[model samples]
Target chain A: GESVGLHLPTLSVQEGDNSIINCAYSNSASDYFIWYKQESGKGPQFIIDIRSNMDKRQGQRVTVLLNKTVKHLSLQIAATQPGDSAVYFCAEGSTSNDYKLSFGAGTTVTVRA
Target chain B: IAGITQAPTSQILAAGRRMTLRCTQDMRHNAMYWYRQDLGLGLRLIHYSNTAGTTGKGEVPDGYSVSRANTDDFPLTLASAVPSQTSVYFCASSVAAGVGEQFFGPGTRLTVL
Candidate 1:
């Protein structure tokens, strides 16, 4: 399944439930992708990152899945907490290029207790 | 240490007024970027500097200009403010270019009247 911005786009999960946020990268040339979490009245923070060579990577309780064939990326948060509620942005980076990061519109996550 | 701090956290400016959003990074990163985030549209790159003393345009660079005079500062200036330029501006930097994660600042919210 592809995680375009508009397909099953918005996900709502109760507190403590696992949450999955998805994104689709358009450029096959992108070799690096990063997930950033932006909370209210704050800036985006690096959550986790994965290279195109790897399909899955984990950090703490967060996991990032990359599918190159379909050009998809997904972030899974285990035991999603209330503090996890924020907009998540996925940015794609190209190795051959300097420092151009193509960012998505961002997905707003709401956690309900 | 202040990871990254933006001046005038929020501003209200009149049309045709000139405003400069200051971004200072203490990380001593070689690369820095400026992006503007709109409501529906994703974060669009305005300008970027791979290293100090050089700059380049990004996806959207028409209304913005940037200067990387030194290693720690990258400021974005709007010659003449316009309503279309009203959006949240973010400053980000990465330890390395090509393939690496980026750390972002708190962001500046600008509203042009």
Candidate 2:
């Protein structure tokens, strides 16, 4: 079965630095991808999303890039802050499957002051 | 507007016991989802409802059930919990099936001992 997965399990970044998380998916039919941030003791929150039609999308201090050829997706956070420390997950979905999303294992990000 | 709300922040239950986790969203979204978060496993969908009366099984639906009695609520029930059922459960709602962003609830932490 096709799945979504992250390249790294953990990432430590200095405050004010840029952070990037990578994800790989196996389903070529997937057209919608989303990034979520999960803080301790809380549910995952929507960060940003990009569709297969576009290569990239930008949000508040965050950007999502999609590479359909490689089935790869990434989330970049600018000026990393301590508040940004959390577990990040990438999910993929397709309209064919009623938009049911398949989520990656997750990448835990830690910011140093 | 209190996007989503879940009951019982945490719980510890013995094996064979039954439990129901509550979830509600004021957004009146048309789609609701239940997912379980485990160490190294990220989030796995258990069940989903496209609308008030329609339901579907997801990746890990065994031992769990869900009901969408109305637009504002989607509750997940565990029939005879087991040790493997110990995990954090998150409830989410989207504007419509396969159409928009998903808003998640805080989550319910369940430990089946």
Candidate 3:
């Protein structure tokens, strides 16, 4: 069975702190992974992505790390701000050519000022 | 530019009724997808289109149908609405399939009684 799951349901962090969100996927064949951010009443926005060939990828204030051996993926947000409060989801892409994705349950991060 | 737009921000409908959710993208991407988001379950793909004339069923496609008559539009149709179908629907588009980033719409909240 293919399943993508998050380690935490919620995370509360103080402003300017660093936040790390963890995710795990059961599909070893999945070669591509992506992170998404969803705010209240809005659809998800793409944050970052990593391929099985790479161990890490960084974007603006976010970093995505992939550990293929354990099928684990993590998103690190630096200097977490109040505007960063949102639900984050990790998705794994299938081996097919269509880039079909399986999303994780999601972890809600609350950045308190 | 409006990357992606979904019609009817929110809707309340009775069970057993038919409903259609419209999705359009101004990016003129070759791939479009429909997904439903639910509490604790994450977002599940309902259907997808690789091009203007090709469509495929996704993980949770049993209760939904879709059509992609053109590159900009991919509409999802529910033959008979059920309470279980209540969820926020999102439409996404990517420049190409398999390895590109996806841009998501705001989402449409649907409720059934």
Top candidate, metric lDDT: 2
lDDT of 3: 0.93
lDDT tens per residue, model 1, B23-105: 99998898899989887666788999989999998888998999999999999999999999999999988776753667788
Output the number of the DockQ-best candidate: 2
- Candidate 1: where is the Cα deviation over 4 Å? A1-8
Q: Write the per-residue lDDT of candidate 2 for residues B8-73, one digit (tens) a residue.
A: 899999999999999999998999999999999989999999999889999999999999889999
How does candidate 1 fare on TM-score? Answer: 0.94
Ranked by TM-score, top first: 3, 2, 1
> Each prediction's TM-score against the native?
0.94, 0.97, 0.97
| B48-104: candidate 3 lDDT, tens digit per residue | 998999999888999899999899999999899999999999999998777579999
What is the DockQ score, from 0 to 1, of model 1? 0.80
Docking class of 3: high
Q: Model 2 misses residue B68 by how many Å?
A: 1.1
When summed lDDT is taken over every stretch of 10 residues in candidate 1 chain A, the lowest stretch is: A1-10
Question: Which pairs of residues clash in candidate 2, taking residues 3 or more apart in a chain or in different chains?
Answer: none
Q: What DockQ does each candidate score versus the true complex, computed on alpha carbons?
A: 0.80, 0.87, 0.86
Chain B TM-score of predicted candidate 1 relative to the true chain B? 0.96
Q: Model 1: which residue pairs collide? A: none
What TM-score does each model's chain B reach against the true chain B?
0.96, 0.97, 0.97
